[model samples]
Target: MILLIDSGNSRLKVGWLTATEDAATQTTANGQTAGPLMRREPAAVAFDNLNPHALGDWLGTLPQTPRLALGVNVAGPERAQGIHDALARHGCPVRWITSREQLLYLKNRYTEPTQLGADRLVALLGVRSRLPSAHPPYVLASFGTATTIDTVGPDDSFIGGLILPGPVLMRSSLARGTAHLPLANGQVTEFPTDTHQAIASGIAAAQAGAVLRQWLAACRYYGQAATLFVAGGSWPEVEQEMQRLLKQTGGSPNTHPTAYYLDRPVLDGLALIAAQPDPLSF
Candidate 1:
């Protein structure tokens, strides 16, 4: 068993991968079984509040102790230390993943590639690994504490992206920065009459606008439609608005870029990286 962790800004996601042999891939010449065979397992996952105590307890609940642990941390070095210590207690040290100039066919186009977040890089790799046959122009939107909308170009390169305040932050900042807004808890309506609805509607619009702009820009740059993958906590609040926006927008030569919501893509990506025989090689 292998353990994979993604320590994000707000939470920590853990996945347990139990590798098994594939019956189809195990056969060799002369109807003899191969020396070794392994197939990918659908990982079982769990989460914690990013606290050392909570995370440690969760690790203790795993079905069996993992032999190796691999993870990516963007929650700061302190949290990284906590994760390291917890895994170390279980006798399975973690190998932290970082950004790279390149990873096999995927190239980092960031001016300073190392500055890119490991979560984003790993998430992109996860998407690419899932869509092995598809080529170019993919948009990934993560709406957590902060919203990140990134694009993968035709050449399989990270073409940079936009980072903006998430819906929660936008509303909280409004309430925090000013005195009048009472931390809007209103639902989004077509025409908001009250302040609460107005704040909620505006925040929804902002998130949708950011996602749409990036998706459309990628479409125009690549001269084709781009598939959009959205993940994170605030997705439920923004999905409807984005779907409305896409309907209002034209597709023309290409069909509408399908928007699919993914749960914990960062974890998915990390699991894929950890499964690699030489993950650090990338």
Candidate 2:
């Protein structure tokens, strides 16, 4: 078994995969279709700091020790070191992933490819591999601690993307920067009458607006409606607002753009990468 880990700013997501399985025969337990190599459900743990004991306890539940371990870390150098140490204690040698100029059929368009986050690149690769025949100009909107709307051209090149503070981060920033925002805790509405609702609505609108803006740009660039794939922890709230905005703006009736919700895109991407003949060569 190959272990895949996505150590992001807010959580640690881990999964196990077996590349030997035929893609045609495998089914994902989460109701979403399984990728070519994923063999089972992934597990997630939230963390504000690196806790090796907690991670080790979770690792203890694995069916068996993974023969090969691979991961991508956006949690900084200190946390990366901690993860490396924890994996070593569990008898798994880890190969942490980094952004690359080219991998498989995908090409990176970033000015400095390595400066791009591995999570974003891997997520694009996962989506591309999962829907190889999908019409291009694709937009991937990931709503985690920081929201990102990344684009892939018709040629499967990772063009670029937009990033902004996510819902919780936005709320927190407002509370911290201002004297009396009180950290918004209310529902999103079309016309928010109070401060709490207004803050909630504003945050959702900002995220939704970015997604729609990118979708429109992708459509124009590709000369056709582009597909929008949403992922990450904050996707549910962001998607709800996106749908509402699309309806309000009448952007869906004629365009009929496709949208997919991927529950564990990072894990899926890591699994696909691990299945490669030389997983670490990249």
Candidate 3:
């Protein structure tokens, strides 16, 4: 069994994959295809913080102890180190995912490619694995604490990208940095009629608009219309807005970006990396 853990800023997405030769067909309780032949095993987990103790607890719940556990963490070095230490205690081999300088048909151009966020690298890696020959390159956008846009050129080079404040952060900044704005939970359904909705919607619009603008600019700068991918915690709220803004700007709405909610891109990337060895195994 392989344990793929994706530790994000707000939550963690854990996926379990088991390898066995059971010819018997299986199905989820809901009758969804789930079995070895189908390449699926209904996996579950408990919600926990980025704490090692919480992660350890989640690991303990697995049906069988994992022989290999790979993690993709975006919480910085300190948190990643802590999670690594805890996983090691369970005797399950573990590795932290890293950015690729030249792998999966993609070359990283960051001054220090390794310094790029593991989450971003892993996400792009997964994108590249599927798009080995995609024209115009791949554009990855993660909507989290801060929304990020990373461009992998048509030739598979990490051409770098831009970042802007996320919707939540933008709203919080306005509520905190300004006095007139009252702190309100981000729950505006549509454009608000009052000051609260006005502020929240404005923030959402700015974040979504920035993402749309940056993606278009990246397409122009890269000389190819790249495939856009969007992932994050609060993306559902702003995804429509992003699509709307992109279409309004004459960009193809279908190419606005695809949203991945439970995706642990780094973990998926790690799974891919583990399948093949590279310069940096970890």
Question: Cα RMSD to native, each candidate?
Answer: 7.9, 4.1, 5.8
TM-score for every candidate vs. truth? 0.87, 0.87, 0.77
Cα lDDT tens digits, model 2, 108-136, are: 99999999999999888777766655456
User: By TM-score, how accurate is candidate 2?
Assistant: 0.87
Off by over 4 Å in 1: 20-41, 48-50, 251-255, 280-282
Tens digit of per-residue lDDT, candidate 3, span 182-243: 87654454567788767767776876766666677776887766566666676766765665
Summing lDDT over every window of 10 consecutive residues in candidate 1, give the lowest-scoring window: 21-30
For candidate 1, write residues 223-267 as lDDT tens digits: 987877788878878877787787677745344445666665676
Local distance difference test, candidate 1: 0.76
Sorting all predicted structures by TM-score, with the top scorer first, yields 1, 2, 3
